[model samples]
Target chain A: MALSTHTTTTGFLLPSIHSAPPFFTQQPNPTTQSIASEQWIRLILSYARHRRLFTLRVEDAETAGNDWDEVLRNERINRRVLPSYLSAIIASMAAKNVAAYEPPKQNRSALLYWRLPEEWAEVLHEWAISTGQLNTILTFYDITDPPIESPLTNIPLPLLRKAITILAKTNRAQLIGVADGEGVRFFAGSK
Target chain B: MHRRGVGLAAFDRQEQSKRSFAELSSALSQSQVDHLHSQLSQFRTALAHFASTHRDSIKNDPSFRHAFQQMCSSIGVDPLAGPRKGGWWAEMLGLSDWQYELGVQVVDVCVSTRERNGGLIEMSELLRLVSRLRGVMGGVITEDDVIRSIKTLQPLGAGYQVVDIGGCTMIRSVVKELDEDQTVILAVAQLNGGRIVEDQLIQQKGWTRDRARAALENMLLRDGLCWLDDQDEEFGRSYWVPSAMQWDI
Candidate 1:
């Protein structure tokens, strides 16, 4: 049978290589493994962007129904990436800086950087300016769980803090202590 | 014939006539030599003119190029030989440029897809990618054209070689040789739609399980010629030779 691209029920199009069974296995050759790693990295980051998923856990490969299911498993071929292989791919992603282990010290899970923190910083600033929230004190809750949905909605806390930290370097945002959690005040900083 | 030579003067006269005859023959052959030279130059001029006029068709038309190449071979000329090497057909046709450009593309596709296929690509897939790289302006290229372009790449010593396995043509970009077992595995994988298991090899080729495993493992670890698929429903593990596999993309 010809290996072809398949669209998942959730509307993500898996590349044709995804249909190939070897793609799920960890290749023995470093060169071949690198190819698999790159494909997985690209698929993961793109899927994360498509579904607004910010985190990938190795345990997701152990079971279905996670945000990574559409990519980590290929039911048509009766194949799913082993947790070992998924962990390797994640580690490669981490080494390449496309992802980072969230909470700083553990390696089981990572925050997927579909958009790197630098890019997220711009998005956060732009949203603050457009929504007339500039120069206002907004809690992390206000940004992550906005009244209306946002690009930042459901963004993991660690990634959000990274973006905020990046912005603070430019004086575009300042961290301020709040009653329940920390808040941030945005400024109409110069480019 | 009229009278017998009577003295030394008669003998000297006979010698003079013989020398004159030799001189006449030499003069006649010199003219023939000059005529032959002009004829050869005329042939060269005509071939050069023909090459210049139909250069585009020679580069853009596959059949025409094939026919032209056949004609060149029949006439004992190499279509690719350059002027520095003393053959003018390539120079006048400007076909070598077209050919070298194609060689570059052949390498491009082979090198770019090396990771996926382990430096061995199916011939048809190589042609597809090369034609795509050339875009519409590159015109149609045939299998002969690809083979010819590959020939031009020989001097680079990059170990690009065309190998026939399982009745399928594959280009191997790496220098490694396909051992006897690996060759058989590739042939069987081609028959299996790129999937092969130890049982399949044992049943079909009568190989022991250990032999099958060793060959597949070498392909996977030593050459990167095949990929390991651990989730095969029947065998639980299978080997896939990407060069034998048909990739639609």
Candidate 2:
């Protein structure tokens, strides 16, 4: 087989290596496995960043119709990354610090760090300043489920909290308590 | 006038002996030297004429170049001995420069793909990659040309070698040697399009499970020559040798 590159239905260009049958398997050789894992990590991060996805679970490989379907499985070759193999890949990614176990306790799933929390901090601050939401008390729910969709919209709570914490260090933000749950007030902190 | 020489003096044992043997020997040597000088000049003129007329053919035409190389060997000439070893005759053709340039490109392709193929590349794959690297203007090259270029690379002692395994030609850029069982594994993998399973080896080669596993594991773990496919459909695990695989890239 040529193992040519293919464009997915979602318009992401898959690298040619993704079409190879053995690419889905967890390699036994450390060197070979490292190369494969490096490729998978790069592919995963880029795809997650493209679709604005932030989570990857072993269950996604077990079931169908998940956001990672395009990558975790190659329907053409009848090959899919087995759950155990994907778990191994996730563990590898976590070891590399490119990803982490989501919920902070489970190993089967990961919180994809498409954008690190530090990067998200800058984006968060820039978003608040540009939208004229500065000096306003914005609740966690309001930022994640904004009326107008935003970079932060649908962002997982823990990741959003981490970004807020990073901003609080720079004195660009302050945490407060609203009537419902919790909130944060933005400050035009000196640059 | 020569009749007196045919007298008894001509048969003298020690008096004359055909006007002294030393003088006759010197006379023969002088004439032989003159004849050899004329022959050497003629050969040089013919060679110079051939070099000027067919230099481009030697450089650009593969078939013509092959024929020319054959003729050189038939005449006991080493074209690739180059100007350093041989005289300026081969240099006049500039064919060694072409050969050396092609060798560089061959090394380029081999080194670039060494990581994926584990320094063992199929001959045809190496040819295709080298051709693509040269681009359209680089002219077309045949497998013969690549083999010849590799010969030019032998002096570098980087251990570039052409190996024949089960009738397939492979270029091995790495210095490593393949053990007997690994050789069989590679040949089988080539037939199956780079995929090999332990069961197949056990059945076809009459190898025991332990022998098969040892060979496959050595290839996968020790050499990094083959990749492990744990999710194989028919078998849970299979070995895929990248060098044996036909990659269009």
Any runs in candidate 1 off by more than 4 Å, and if so which?
Answer: B1-97, B134-139
lDDT string, candidate 1, A1-191, tens digits:
78778888899888889988888999888988888899889999999888888889999999898777888888888889889888888899999999999867988898899999999999999999999999889999999999999888878788888889999999999989999989999999899
Report fnat in order of the candidates.
0.74, 0.66
Per-residue lDDT of A44 in model 2: 92
Worst 10 residues of 1 chain A by lDDT: A66-75
Q: How accurate is candidate 1 locally (lDDT)?
A: 0.86
Question: What tens-digit string does per-residue lDDT give for candidate 2 at A1-191?
Answer: 56678899998989877877888877777888888899899999999998999999999989999899999989898899889889998999899888889788889888988899899989999989988999999999989998999899999988888889999999999989999999999888986
TM-score of each: 0.77, 0.71
Q: Which parts of model 2 are misplaced by more than 4 Å? A: A188-191, B1-108, B137-139, B144-159, B202-210
- The TM-score measured for candidate 1 stands at 0.77
lDDT of 1 at B247: 73
